[model samples]
Target chain A: MTTPLVSIDNLTVAFPIGRKLFGPPPMVKAVKNVSLSIPKGSFVGLVGESGSGKTTLGRAILQAAPITDGKITYDDGERRYDIASLSKDKLRDFRSQAQLIFQDPYAALSPRMTVRDIIAEPLEVMGLTKTREETDARVREIAAKCRINLEHLRRYPHAFSGGQRQRISIARTLAAGPKFVVADECVAALDVSIQADILNLLKQLQRDLDLTYLFISHDLSVVAHVCDYVAVMYLGEIVEEGPTREIFANPQHDYTKALLAAIPSLDPDQRSRVVSFERGTVTVDG
Target chain B: MSLLSVENLSIRFKTDEGLITTVENVSFDIQEGEVLGLVGESGSGKSVTAKAIMQLNGRNTVYDPASKITLHGGPDIDILSLKRERDMLPIRGGQISMIFQEPMASFAPAITVGKQMVEQLQIHTTMSKAQAKELSIEMLDRVGITEPARRFDQYVFEFSGGMRQRAMIAMALTTKPRLLIADEPTTALDVTIQRQVIDLMKELIGDFGMSILFITHDLGVIAQTADRVAVMYLGRIMEQGAVRDVLRTPAHAYTRGLLNALPNLDNLDAPLTPIPGDIPSPLERPSGCVFHTRNPELAPGSRYETEIPPMSEIRPGHFAALFPEDVQ
Candidate 1:
């Protein structure tokens, strides 16, 4: 259990801004020298703001983004692969082991496809099962685990509400049986009550499936609720990392402390402290 | 004295399915210089009630004859009586300025941010062009936008998300309206930027001393800004009271459900207890107590399902929709 499912060292992801015929093009480094280890079956949280490079780090680990430098090793007991140096054949194999869930449920799924077809598409593409009968069986199993109603599977995406659509999306992601899942703001679009339901479902599935998760979100309270380990990401770098309780109770970095302080407290008698981010005072790396 | 009062407000939209009542028998009043928070989920009809005050609903929308909205500022203006759009002019930007959730959508893409501010002033007041421009720049600077003179000529797309929201605030406050209706102003921004905007609004409220009808679903934001709180369900006001009294000691079951669903930083280990069911669609709206279907406290055949409970005053200012069957 102590073995790291995902190990990274000095990972960097940069995109070229503009093209100039004369000199080398300027580069925007979305992620810079980030190193972290997600232990097997552990829920690791990555927290940051818009320009903080949390999403970039998640994408870089999946090899969806180009890695300019550094090493990424994903090991899920049976298969060991270096994500940065995967060949076409190995890349296909790596994708089956890892998957990602997006933020918007409305746009995530196709309108024309039925819920059963949408969930079955992943397994079919990955060639996880040989026959249509096996695919149907697997889809039904994942749907039940995600708390999706079996009767609703024959209907289209438009028939469901935002929360229901999100459940369908989760069922699709799990169809391929990914050992590592990167849930990027998965529950941000939902209402508070439904958001709780989805969070509980995710926790239960994590236990039942024995999967590892890298949960990326901007909401600190949500991260504190489900994550076992917390990593605080600032601009292109992780400022701090520790157990969720210790990181929240005794944060070392000033940015982490400021983030925790800014959440509006529920008590009306107390004033929720507002630490305005004065952008001019801080320096940025070129 | 109260600055605005809305009584027995009911709004229904004529849809293909039928007439769907979005807001029903909702009533509340806002005192001068006080912020009243309207809290509700997506189908809760909080926004419909806010828009009904300004007559901003669509063509298919219908308001009941019994609904009455009175603005007690400057002159006693019967808002519902102003049938013509032209009659709505004096109240729209003159007395009540409104800011929306999306800052970019509110602004004109082709025009400079400063020009829009000046245009708003011209529509509401008779200030000279030069005077309006000067005032616009000053207001922008007051909202903490650095180099206001420079930012004045810049388009909205050029500004960052936080800065664009600051520009929106600057525009809304330029007319010096007596009341402001802010609908989810900070929902789209990052937490750090959201804090900045909240602080700016608090400082502005202190300086202007105007009433605000703040509408949003986030309880934390409501706790930070509002003085009084009104919790709304499908189409009814479930609870209303002074912020301290209502939030500290919530009476209605729906209000209790909402608070329980939020992630508590103080009690990290406590499980979030969500209300049992979804907000029923308009076609299947409950007849008596709007939230009876989702109320975890009561089961089927309860009295709440048969009768619409009156909003009884539990304390001096706190009120909740409850029946004697449960209160005793």
Candidate 2:
């Protein structure tokens, strides 16, 4: 088998819950023993509810979260690094190859920065380009790839709509030319109509750039459309991982089944007929 | 007779940029025991339409002079005509109640859940303080809150997100209002909590025979709970019909775009066909059909750009603004 672009082995992220003064501080165990892999150029989706640790798992893979145990390796076909055990130099190199697209576009971008500045910051911070002309060329090229209007790049983020801001967010992420990207609920905040436009753009860019995506979202409907392979996370563990069609057609886990059954559809009268598993129920299968 | 009738209603916001027209000549009805789902994307004016009925918009909101909002079997008061706060009170909570997207904003943090309920009930009804307290507790139990009396004394913060929504619903339903305007009430909730809330609302609707003007951007939620679905865009009704008809056989291009954009559980790998171009700013309202700019079927320099498409009945009880292609 080809070496996967990203690999994980028994990754766990634990956050101290109580204050230091409290007796025997307990860990929240946000992510517990999650293991997964993403092949090169595959659009992979990580889906779960609010406390399911899907977001934490994504951050852990990026080494943004404190990995309490286990190993995550990133190989971009050029250089390899143990994400959790990287030196400062290796970390700086890794930054050029791995990037994250935030869920809330409003809070992610600096309001004070112009769209050009926002997109150029990553390239400037990484020192990928030395001259002003080089930086402008890269920013405009990536901005066009993300389908942003070139004229709008001079305006502040507040001037653009949600969809436009998202394009800027995508441009910034892609400006780094990362081999692997984690787009965390990137379209959840946009309108349904606008959401489709963004999703389609992301798909087109993925093909053009041969980029591997780790799309994190609570919306099953979105994941169903964008992802080829999906991993259903629950309480910090992946309960089911399979091809998107197989999982959606015949979801093995009860939680996955419920999540599928819960999407409010265009058909106003289509209610959930399946029995939902209540909290504290013991699972018969993984 | 319908429980509520909204006719020729239009709303515009007085932004610094100018009067940005949001919702245009929109009209619909809510039956005594029916759920009317207003489905649209951001700037579709679904929320604005619902809010117009409640007169909930700020001072800068301009309701068109020709707007007529009548409540049947209500207090015989014209909702739009009621100018004074005292005049709007009986209609606001007594006959009609509203639930919001965020429950926390509507709920008070300093007061106990029961105290707020009792106070709301006292102000609406002629019940004594003790009587209101007892009734409010029973209402909480009715909404399936475990240990109603014990939970009543807890502050809004004590309740979880789901529990807080349930409490909000309990408070809204206490007055036994005839109409309920739920504006994306489950948008912020998890799938599981959203399911629970939908189930609870269905039960309440059946029991009380109350009409619900359900507003949400999620087509799936509207499909599950609403009897009739109205698709709105740029402050106008794009289409309206039975949920089954509108969703399964959407006639309007905007409605089709919304359904197509929705990720289907059946086809996980199919790329979402999002409508191209962002929703036009309210300030630059379209000249003809509001959706023409984004409609794929639109021909350049077509009549749609020059002439407004009037809403025409396409089938029995199904209405949509027809394009040139739709006529023949």
Candidate 3:
């Protein structure tokens, strides 16, 4: 097919545990040799339990995490940047194009700043807008797109609820006009009803802005619902990746099957249907 | 007779802003050996209701005079009437024990897991330290902790997330409480671990013949563990009924919205329809029905906006807080 927006080839990220005088210093490989591709304007989900290295891979794609090996290429069909060897100036330019939406809305936003200032901070930091008026206009435009009322712009994050605060965070992420966003567990903290609202907002924003999203979450039902493609991470390795429908319908990996069965079903009659796996059976691969 | 009965329960907290009503006129009952699930969002006051049963709210909490909680195993005891903390000791951990969402917070960091469990047993029962230790080891092994003897001497930090939660469960059940309050115990667990915990709880419930008040925001967990379910919204019970009836045919508009909002595996292509509008802040609670603001079925200026609907019986045992005329 055509060129993908972001392509990862055998990416690896490792952290040294401690200082060593002789031999090799023991290192923990967070993201093992794994390769994946994200089509332009598609919502790709990377799902794994804790310590599965999903978060590290997401950070590596944005060049926020150290790339110990392999390559990551980002292309918007305009300019392609090899993220591993970007210069200071080029990395700054890339920052505006790649953004991150954090999980905890409470901790992500600055409590001291008004909603207006929080959204405008990204634009100001990147020097994307020229004047104060231009910054305000851009902020308001993205705020309106995110469904945040203009009246609430003067209020601090403390005044907003969890769902409203998340909308403000999304507005800030989009204010930078990023082509790709890594929403790491962005909707995990929200109530189910509120989660649907945020998911719909993200999907709507993708259509309106033609944005590519790396939706990182541990909730399988959520990934099945929103993501166009799904990748399963197990112990720093991608055990499975395919279209969401295909993966959900016929999971090839044992870990993927276990995860799907582990989800508590809403139907009361299905209570006895859960497939049980022995403890420590799904531990990380060496 | 029911194991526990809460009648006309109303709870308010004296905050700096004003007296905020967190739970209003809520009432429910749990039979012996029954599991009743209390389901709601963050501000729906499910946690407050659970805490009120244990009398565990902060100092600012004010309970209405009409509120009554009765525990009926031995002599019918009025739980709310026990004004002193010492008088409520037997009910708190002896008759009723609680496990929280965060096991780390509940566990003592400096002490060994076995010490805490034995200490609790000594306080509640006439068990010697040696006997308590033996019982604690057995309990740990029952909860599926490997190397129970070694784990008994370890601190909470030494245990994994799932193991810690299991240890908390083991500690809570060590006393063989008549009623257990599990406030989102599985919410913090991974899905696989959650499955294990849920299975363990079911097995323990059967073995001990104890009732449980399972509070959580997830309907899936409620469906699996609860015999009965109560749906709350903004400090009010919107629906109460058998789990099967509630899940199969939800009567309340808010209940319907909640079920619709969930991403079901049965229909992957179905669009998720969130309940409209954010849950109104407790400070600015609506004038009439608590869920009217976000309920899509209610028209603007409808009677539901001005008058509170009583819990009307739709099925034999299923009740929905809606006008009789509203029921289809």
Candidate 4:
């Protein structure tokens, strides 16, 4: 079998809660012992409800989260990186290959920065280009690739609409020449019509740039729409993982079935609400 | 007779830029014990129309003289004619209660949930403090909140997202109002939690015999919950009909565009077709059909560009912004 572009092994992310004076503190295990893999250039989706650690796992792959245990390996057919164990110099090298697209576009970009400056900042921070002309050329190229209006590059982010701002966000992410992108609920904040535009843009960029995506979202229908493979998380564990079609067609886990049954169908006669949510009797949130 | 009737409703807000009309000549009726969904994208003025029923808009809001909103419940009350906030008291909580997209926005973080619920009951109902507290606890339990009595003493920040929403629902329904204006009540919730809330609302509607003016950008939610539907674009109602008619066979171009934009679960292979062009800014209002700019079937600079079509009957109970001959 071909080596996957990114692979994980027994990843566990825990945050210590109550502190102890003499002993260890109690912990909340956000991501339990789990493993996932992304094939090269595949749009892999990570879907789960809030507090399910889907976001934490996405951050862990980029070494943005504190890893209590396990390993994450990133290999792009050129250089290999054991993300959690990389040295400072090696981590700086790996940073250029991995980037995160935030969930809220409104909060992601700096309000005062011009569109050109925002996109160019990443390329400059990574020192990808030496000269001013080279950086300007790269920014314009990415703006066109992301379908942003090249003429409006001098305006601030406040001047653009939500869809236009998202295009700017995409341009900034890809400017650093990343091999893998973690799109964390990138379209959740936009309207459905605008959401389709962004999703289509992401699909096109993936094909054109040869990029692998870890699309993290709570919306499953969207996952089934764009993802090649999907892994469903519940309470810090992977309950199901397979091809998008197979998982949607025959969801084995009760939790996965419950989730799929919850999406309201567009057809009036086919509201098959087969699964019902019963609040956790064991829940102890005081 | 319908429980509430909104006719020729138009609303404008006084802004620094100038007077801008957000809702234009929209009309609909909410029958007793039925859900009427106002479906649209952002800036569609669905929420503004609902707010106008309770006279909840800010002081800068200007309601057109031609606009009329009437409540047909015991003595017919002209909603638009009420001049004072105190006069709106009976209609605000006693006749109509509203829930919003974010429960946090509606809830007071400083107060206990139970205290707020009891206060609402005190203002709206004749029940004493002891009676109100008991009833509030009962409502919390009814909405499926566990340990309702204990949770009632907790502040809004203590409860989880789903629980907070349920708490808000309990507070809204505590008055036993005739109408519930749910403005994207479940949009912030997860799918499973959203399903629970929708089910709860359906169950409550059955138990209380209430009418709902449900506003949302989601067609799927409307398909599941609404008995009747009105499709809004820009500031106008492009189409209105029975839920089955509108969803199965939409007559308007904007309605078709919205349905096409959603990712269909059955056919995963078909590419998503977003409505072309951005939604026009409120400052640059289109002259005729507001949706004509993004409309795919019709051509720009045509007669329809300047001629605003009326909502003519397409079928027995279906109406669209096109004449009978225009229906394809």
Q: Whose DockQ is greatest here?
A: 3
Give the lowest summed-lDDT range of ten residues in model 4 chain A.
Answer: A277-286
> Which is superior by TM-score, 3 or 4?
3
**Which residue ranges in model 1 land beyond 4 Å of their true spot?**
A274-286
Query: Model 2: per-residue lDDT, tens digit, A77-111?
Result: 77999999999988988988889998888999999
Instruction: Give the fraction of true interface contacts kept by model 4.
Output: 0.79
Per-model CA lDDT versus the true structure:
0.90, 0.87, 0.93, 0.91
Q: What is the lDDT of residue B154 in candidate 2?
A: 94
Which whole-number lDDT from 0 to 100 does residue A250 have in model 1?
A: 93
Q: Chain A TM-score for each candidate, in the given order?
A: 0.96, 0.95, 0.95, 0.96
Residue A18 CA error for candidate 1 (Å)? 2.8
Per-residue lDDT tens digits of candidate 4, residues A63-112? 99999899899998789999889999898888899999998889999998
DockQ of each candidate relative to the true complex: 0.75, 0.69, 0.85, 0.79
Candidate 1 local lDDT, residue B275: 76
User: Number of the top candidate by TM-score?
Assistant: 3
How do the predictions measure up, each by TM-score?
A: 0.97, 0.95, 0.98, 0.97
DockQ of model 3 vs. true complex: 0.85
Clashing pairs in 4: none
Candidate 4, A79: how far from true, in Å?
0.6
lDDT of 2 by residue, B132-244 (tens): 98988898899899999999999988887888899999999999999999999999999878988998999998898898999998888888898898998888899999989
RMSD, every candidate, angstroms: 1.8, 2.7, 1.6, 1.9
**Per-residue alpha-carbon lDDT of model 1 for B1-328, expressed as tens digits?**
9999999999999999999999999999999999999999988998888888878989899999999999995679999999899999988977998888999899999999999999989999899999999999999999999999999999999998889999998888989988999989999998888888998999999999989999999999999899999999988999999998888889999989988999999989999777776678778889789999889898789889978999988888999999855653
Native A-B contact fraction in model 3: 0.79
Runs off by more than 4 Å, candidate 4: A276-286
